[model samples]
Target: MNILLKMLLSMSIASVILIPLVWFLKKVFGQFLTKRKSYYAWGVVFFFLIVPFAFFFVQKNTEFLWGTPSEFAGLTSMVIGQNGIEVERSTQAVIFQFIMDYVWVLWLMVGLIMLVYRIASYRNFKKFVISGAHYIEEPDELDILAEAMETIGLNKPVEVMINPLISSPVFFGFRREIIVLPSTSFSKKELYHIFLHELVHCKSKDMYVVFLAQIFTCIYWFNPLMYWMIRQLERDREYACDESVLSYLPARDALSYGDTLLHSIVKSGTYKESHAAVSLHENAKMLKERLEAIASYKKGKKGYISFLLLLILLTLIGILLNFYEAKAFIYEKKQGIEIKKEDTSKKTEFRAIDLQNANQDVTIRKGKTESFDLTTYDENSKAELVVKNGILMYKNANPNTQSAIIITIDADKVYDSLSIQTTGTQIKISDIHTKTMRIKGGVIIAHFNQIKADTINVTTGSANVHLTDSEVNKGMKFNGNNALIHFEKSSFNNLEMTSFLSAKLNDLNVQGGLSINSGGQLDARNITTDTLKLIAGNSGNMKFQNTFVKKSSEFQDNESMLLQFDGVLNGQTRMSIGPSQTKFVIRDKMQKYAIDAQSSQADTFILNQSIVNYPFTQNLSAPNNITLTNDSPFNNNFNLSFEE
Candidate 1:
């Protein structure tokens, strides 16, 4: 249904742009277009109207241009919860969604109404014409019809009838051709001319064109230009049929044909047009123009080929631009360098360690004595390991080597500083004490277990970092892009984490404060912090379960956010959300907390599963205070619940 609506919208917009352009080109280069070519130019409009469906079909069948790595699906699902958590929606959001879900039904209803009305009208007109009609039994009329069919090169048999109800000569029916003429006396030459004109319409399949135009008009009933285009096409059909008849006649017979048209117009009444039929004379409004066109008809140059090609090219370009998909590239691991299994251990005395540009798995642990072991991938690859001024510095010359170069370091003494930087490396550190430690890499996988540090910082691009059973005395900081950071059973004095992707913290305890800025999802469970500050952007979500803040805490998001607190709130917390939904669920109902929530009138706030008018407040004098504010004009949904 969504695809159908999109196709209809595309067709409508394209018609608006192309219809007028075709009309203008015809007017500007009218002399260069023959009547047949001018009528056929409308085919461009019809082609573009159906082009969107072609794009939809191609996208569904082929993977040539739209092939993407499947890993991105996992990544996206991780960033957004896979279980599809339900979130409250504002009134405006609900209305907008309702419209999107049922707008097609409305369009279909209108289109059906137009179709049924057109069919009924056509049926009534057909009945009225057939009721007052009789088959031509005159031998002279039959001979004239045979002569006209032969002149127009029409092999199919046609039924000729005379109807006293209609004033003009018209042809109807698709499978069996029927030509209905007014019940009036005519000379042999005039009868021959009228028969030739209607037969030309039959040979050209002008009724099919009118039928198609009627269907399109029904489909695009909301577009006024559709009606205009159909009217214009009807006029063009008559002119082209006239031109075809003139081509079959002698040059002097043009005057006789013009007289017959004028006579039909003089006798013509306010007869309604039927899409299922083609008439010789339309109306007085188009009669003068038709007579002038007949008098001035000449073989014109076919110069619209370039214009038609240009229209097609533009339409193709539009399709390509609109339907282009993003391509995702997958990373493949290369195998070339060899790993040496033999460990080369060396005694080293250093207070600080620094390793840079190492493409390998590295482990650092505590030992009784200070020593280092090197496991090289390539023996020829020179690696710099030196101790200078109480600092151990290591650099790998061939950092681009594919295989692992494991460097396990063991030190008994607590180091003043420790730093490691690499690209696409796996690092593990355990039971090492340091005043300050920093790790930086690209596409890194790092783990810290039972490690103690005064200050620790880690930065990476497209990485996964885990900290388990670790403690930081001073502060810890993490910055990453397209990365996932996880903390389990970790304690820190002041922890600050920033991720462009996702982060999960479980069983984490912060002595001082905890701060997190995420561009995706952030899930924290069993977390205890003295002070908390969290900022999320671009549809980022933060879900906190069994989490407690001791001091003042602030949470802000530019998009949708979900915060679940199963524990007690001990601080003055402030939540600022944007146009998206924000859900707050507190399972500890016994924990008394004051709430002050404010938002625009368009927003909806549900408290304890019931809609509450805002700016709403409750338990204002309570010790624990919580403030929620969303002032965007768009719908901002707030679901606040307290469950025992």
Candidate 2:
């Protein structure tokens, strides 16, 4: 996933789950919490957004590295002495920009906001005792504070408004609203329950909590986790506030208050305020917990030991999630001109992965073959990596879009890294194997640990070529048109091809025989190898182009290698042979050569027509050679040469 998406997803999940969870937990536990802790509880919740927040910062860091390509004004730092003209190298600028994107110290800002909001909500102390406002006209009849807004003082004073929803005198929370009850029907004990309950909300400033919860919710609207969290907080909040009120009431009064609580709980409704830090009314789940709190109230201070344990549990969770916040990002798009930033990392080797590409299908089994008939290949015809260890085999596995594969590694463990470029690369499971890959164009580069692939092919194309550390196995063949092939430390059995195509195997130890097949010619320069075999047919030619070699890795066992040339050569195919022995069997085209076998000592010769130069080193022969004149030994009267 891209950084933005990761951040957004994290934030949304935490906020969505946290909101309702907080609400529900607070509804159950709110009565037990000291007012300050409830606000602190909320402040602690937004603290969880840090991980998602990192996503936003990392992306901004990337953008800073690569500014808009079509630039106009320079930043103040670049203004030095000219007309604000400054040029930044892309790599250096990006790295420096990452440093300048300084997001590390910003997380404390969320912490600071929480601290400041909590403090400001309860900054001053004010005390008030006033007769209830006539609230019978409005629901939350106790909400007469809204009607008496002009006269209501900061001092905690009851502006009695009857709850139109519930006539029972139950305390509903609003900032600085110390709502007084009417003396006509209410006893001192019933009135006391209302005063202490709402006072706790005002003191805790939970009215501001909804605001804080909403900010996180809005940012991570997509996350169910965050939403779940929010609901839990709200539920706990109510329970905590209820606990505070019960602390001052008699058991009889607590029972009396329970009736009013149950009545109001059933009739509760929502408040229409978008402000942060304050929440009104209960969610469906929160309402259930609030009703349960009336019956579930345990009057005893949770065994001093349990409270200590609870504190310890809270402290540990705080330490973990506090330092690491789940972060989310918000982006605003600009119109008209576009700013694009592309970041790329150097490709590193991961484990080996396999893919089928345009040049070769690396058959899974030895000497196995599979083919795709759609011959019109293009650059966009991407190959799929059947087995992907990491991003090395497939571009789809990477999040950054730039193609690279990074392995997931243990801290100190070692892993092997391998890569392959897909053009004219082949593989054989056993020794002395040849698999011809026909490439219309492109160079193939591949790597293997011990015994890997067989050969590589280069075909005609309107492009320049470059190959490094490329190799092919023994007994491999190359056949193609006017293509330029380059190699370094490359292994091959016998090189033969047609046209102006040439491969400069620059490595000092090139073991296999080098030959130019007769259909076309190849000119290799500074190319040195052992047991050079050259063949030509009519117009084919392979020139020295001056190639040299020091020593050659000799052929081991007879079963270890095979170099067979079945193609017909028309013109001169020549090579400077090194001291190693390589057998060459040329089977066809007697008319193309002047049979030069008489010049070299023979090991075994079957000169039906084709010739092998300097035969003292190894065997040179043909398969079946037969000729008949007017009177032959086998056929006395039949002339196979002179047709009737």
Candidate 3:
């Protein structure tokens, strides 16, 4: 129950509790926070309070439990308590400490990065406002906008306000209460089209999402992806809106709306109202974006396949958000209890010593560069393990078993290896070398390192693993039935592996790589990195994907290679190749890519996918490209497809 309370409390702090705080800030310093206050009161306040603590707490607790004592505790706890004095021997008190070893400091820096990002988000939300459209209202335009509104069956009594101080299209603002326009134009059809667009924003109640995203932004400022998700949500909302509007409006009129949007682009560079919501101030870039979107826009409802893909993406994201833990610890100290990073010394801390028997909490501390190992028989104990200075401590208790490790090092150095004997179902730890940390377990979560380990091994059972940092290094292999691994940030080299819960590698940077082996289910998304190697063996879901990079050109134009393969292409030859430049930033299931090819490949990348709203680049290039195309197209084929 205590453990449950802590878990609930921590989650509340990161989300529910945190969002309100962001709201409070907006209220308290509305005017002060911004000269450009767009959703200032709502977005920043929510994001500010929740993102930092939620991310930090989860990262910290997981690291601390890197290697605690669980297997032994479960095996002996029942028999030992009854025969207390007889159990003098197992592994001496697993002298496990915290996970901040000299080697892990680099990873720990990630926490700082998140902090920096959140702070900037806070500052940005408070500062940025839409402003660039030169509203050329020609007076009496309200009647036209209002008449158009009625034609669309919108009779909720809309407000037609003339913003002599404003600029841009007929905007629907703050809950769709006001529709402002340029004193000059818009025909009945044109006006109706514009109304439909803005109304779509309102119908979807994007106003609410804009508010929600603001909250997320302020808190998770460091995670660029989070912000991108917000934009994506808005973009999707617009796409969905566009589809809805198409139901009533004609093609030519819709095209006119697109044209008018372009004209507005010519007039306004881009005006952000400094509020939480984004309104109609379409600029040149946005104009081009809208054109491209409309050009590829389908007329009717999306099919099951489209929805299935959407569901998969949403499900994967939700799973990541839900099945996460944030463990904590407490501590009391001893003099010079020298601990080693590799020693399981204080394995069970006087197995003879029981919390009920001891008058006070156990206290164990060590000198500089020390370490400890631990195991927990209680389910409650597995979640949080904290240490003060050099001491190891825990609270409450659990009857279920788990294991973890604590290795304390300078916040300035790095480490080499973290090995876990496959014993319990879970292993929690942090701060270590960027090397391969092998574990024989069912569930795994590691935090912040350069070259992260792979394989959350299980002999015959099942395992689920998640790692986080800049990218994924190597991912998990399913030797058993339902063994699954999920890597965040770093690189991957899994050409083949199989299973029910399979391994998922995400956020492979422009520098990261992924290799999908045969018969293995490898789903790669959000590969923001440039060069990656993919080899989908005989049969498997080697889904090549990418996401738009929010990074500037100075940082993106790196000479990286992205290689993928499966079958033949360019012709029916044994093998084929072509020139291309398509890079992906692999997220768990959502990947965005920038493809620049003169002709489309039937078996290459499935085009006309979810309506993606991103600027196109002319400088994109990919020279050494492989093709997975065959004589006949590979429809819904999971295996590889080389594009020539």
Candidate 4:
């Protein structure tokens, strides 16, 4: 839960940065971007919006979780315990922490209200467009509309209505397509221009674009710049329509069309105030811009360049918003503890450590130079520490005793092979680099940081693993049950993780194969792997996101597992979900795959290929097996197998 809150908080900070960038780009390049293309650029914000959440999900160094343990205990009773270990906080810290904890609820409430309002308004507008509308059958008007449709290559049937209540030409309705024009009589030329304009909208599918823009605006309403961007998008969409309409007319007729638009300005209602339909005459200001654009419209090669430039700029902005650097840590005995970068050019190899029978919280961090320190809160506690042959050992002199212990290590040491064996000890190690690191523990809280190892082997009974800013060169594996592993912003050559409880790997770069055998739950996000193999025995939920599995991968599971994928599924991959339900929410552009599977019980397969909205689940029963070939043109190349 704290991790989730941290993500939201990071998003808020990113919003502050992105909002200004968005507005600045609009102001500077507003004129360079092509009309329709500029509207599409607004979609870039949707991508940037997710960038922060993804970034923070990986980096553990954040202000929200920083500080001494005792300084944070009072903010929540959950952190307080019956043992009377109290951590005091200043009033300002408490207030700030409280807001950080609960701000997501506020954000959710605001977004929901905006979503409901947009939906209700859409329904009401649909109703208004439906009731008391009379279809126009004038021979001349019908002929003009038919000619406009033919010119735009639209053969689909449509409804043309004369509605006195409507102030301007409007387009709505999906199944029963309708165009509501003002009841005022029009000359042949004006009517032709109006039909052509609305037909251009129909041909370009601007209505759907407008609707999508509205939905995104509502969801991100907290960002005021999004509102500004939406308004610009609507303007650009109409401008594009105007340009298209002029393309079908003679160059000399451009001014005449502009004159028609200017005349419609007075008769057209303030459609900008209405979010229901794409209508003519947004307001007098937009009307002037449309006239100017129409007057200066010409065929050119500059539109392509502007489009390319816009794409490049948006891509850079996205990268910058999500970029995070590794922070440095340097501590000295005189100044207590401080986080600062320093050169480790003259560092020695890291020392080894062995821990036995630790039941209290243990912290290990970096120091200035070659040194070691051990401190305990309870003097009478039977905890003893010794360093022999460069191997630091911690022991409890009494058999049945436990107490808080702090072990500080020098930051400059680079251990060649470091190993740890703990029993019920909560250990935190940070700011040390090593060649190889291994751990075998039981029921502990272990936090590791800035540790580079060739191989990391973690074997625990029941534990919580929080590791960040680390790298494993050759391979890393986990063997445990009832363990919660949170490994973030780490790189590894190969990963072999097996647990009966749960594990989450976030923002990791894995260059080799990944194998997971779990009986509980598994959640991985922002990951990149060469190949994957998963096996689950009992009921659990598995999720993968923003991950690339390039080589062959397979999953064999017998229990009912809820499997979900929100990223790209590449390479030759297969999954046997057994009787469990598997859902693939494809967010990648290049989609292609193959799946060979078998099922003993009744199985259902769902595929959503349509790009209109989210793909719907298509359930199909397969008693024995189902072969999904790569020849399909559905959602790229996605393959999986299942059995029960």
> Model 4, range 1-644, lDDT digits (tens) per residue?
44544554455455566656765776677677666666566666666665553443343534324323334333423234888545444677777767766776877788789889988988877676667578897888899989889888998888898766666788875566778776557777888898888877777777777777777666566667677767767787798788778878888889989888876655654323248577766777888889998988885524677777877886776666655311211112233233243655334223776665555556777776554444555668757776666677676644355455566666666776666665646778788777777777785688888878788888888788888999888999888778888989999999898874888889998899888888888889998888878776678888887767766667665564576776655555565545455666645432233335333323334445423212212223322222332221222223332211
Q: What lDDT does candidate 2 reach at residue 223?
A: 53
Q: Write the residue-wise lDDT of candidate 3 on 1-644 in tens digits.
A: 32322333344434443343334443454333221122322333333333323334444323323333333321222333554533222343333322222323543365467556645653463333223223335444556556556656666655544433344543434533555554344555655666666765555556666656665454344445455545544544554555566656666556666675666544432334433444564345655765676665445443444334433443343333433433333222223422224555444222111112111112222225444444544545433444433233344434243434343443233324333343343444444433443444333332234333442232324555555663224544434345566766755443223443455666755433222333446566665533333333333444444433222211111111222322111111112222223232222211122233222334343333332221212222332222222222222221222232
Q: Mind sharing the TM-score for model 3?
A: 0.32
- Taken over the whole model, the C-alpha lDDT of each candidate is 0.76, 0.40, 0.40, 0.67
Best by TM-score: 4
Poorly placed runs, candidate 1 (over 4 Å): 53-91, 268-273, 300-644
Worst 10 residues of 3 by lDDT: 351-360
C-alpha displacement of 633 in model 4, angstroms? Answer: 58
lDDT of 2: 0.40
How far off is residue 126 in model 2, in Å? Answer: 22
lDDT of candidate 1 over 434-551, digit per residue (tens): 9999988885688888888999988888888788998899999988878888889989999998865888889998999898887778888999999988877777777888887887
Q: Write the per-residue lDDT of candidate 2 for residues 272-309, one digit (tens) a residue.
A: 22223222234446545565666666666544443344
Which candidate achieves the best lDDT against the true structure? 1
Clashes of 2: 125
lDDT (Cα) of model 3 = 0.40
